[model samples]
Target: MDKIATVKWLDNLCLVGQTSSGHAVVMDGPPDIGGQNLGPRPMEMVLLGLGGCTAVDVIMMLQKSNQAVVDCHIEVSAERAETIPKVYTKIHVHYVVKGRELSEAKVARAVNLSSEKYCSVSKMLEQSAEVTHDFEIVELS
Candidate 1:
């Protein structure tokens, strides 16, 4: 574990994370919501983190399998409970893969590998929601 954040108030999570050069990511929550919003809403960031992680994994796997990846897109949708203890109940991930000579099996395998082994965010989110996925391949000009 690394250095942690101590909450001085509600909605506020301050962390003292250091860069390799000893610089810091001085993050804060929104002041109106008892933080600075400088670090972004935790939930929002979570979604992006998942997308980024899975995106990299997909790209890597496709490249290794020799797919000429022109571009990739991931869309994430989540349903959250509207209550005090809000949590996601369902989530759907759609992957749009644009390339040349793309194999559906290879794309499926890449997605599976990311969700099963590489993406930590997806694994954690799975505990809360029934995560589902689908993919489409688009040939380029």
Candidate 2:
């Protein structure tokens, strides 16, 4: 199935995006580019999408494996090229999983599966950037 989205310019390098799922997000450029900095930059939104996608995958995988998950957070960092059309050159995804007696093996497998097979955003970004992933498990008392 194909998804559709719309981005409408608001003002002064600012825009609003509506997702196919009916969610709305505001985007803006930096002050140097005449942007008011109302919301996140467009490239930042890409990282946000990647983080959200992987977070969902990992959490669901853990739950299906009968792991008692308390929280799951993803941190995404990237580097852009120096030249024009400054596309991302490197990207790293970090997963912090909090749970009760979570199996290390299962957590590792979940993270691996998301980056290597499940996460579509990661797969797409791999075309232009070197995407890497790692995870740490936090046991709940």
lDDT of 2 at 37: 96
Clashing pairs in 2: none
Tens-place lDDT digits, model 1, residues 1-141: 765444233334644444456554445666776666666555665687788889999999999999999999999888888985788888888899999889999999999899888888899999988888888999887
TM-score of each: 0.75, 0.97
TM-score of 2: 0.97
- The lDDT of each candidate is 0.80, 0.96
Off by over 4 Å in 1: 4-40
Once fitted onto the true fold, the runs of candidate 2 whose alpha carbons sit more than 4 angstroms away are: 1-3
Kindly report the root-mean-square deviation of model 2 from the true structure over all alpha carbons: 1.1
lDDT string for model 2 (1-141, tens) is: 676899999899999999899999999999998999999999999999999999999999999999999999999999999999999999999999999999999999999999999999999999999999999999999
RMSD, model 1, all Cα superposed?
4.0
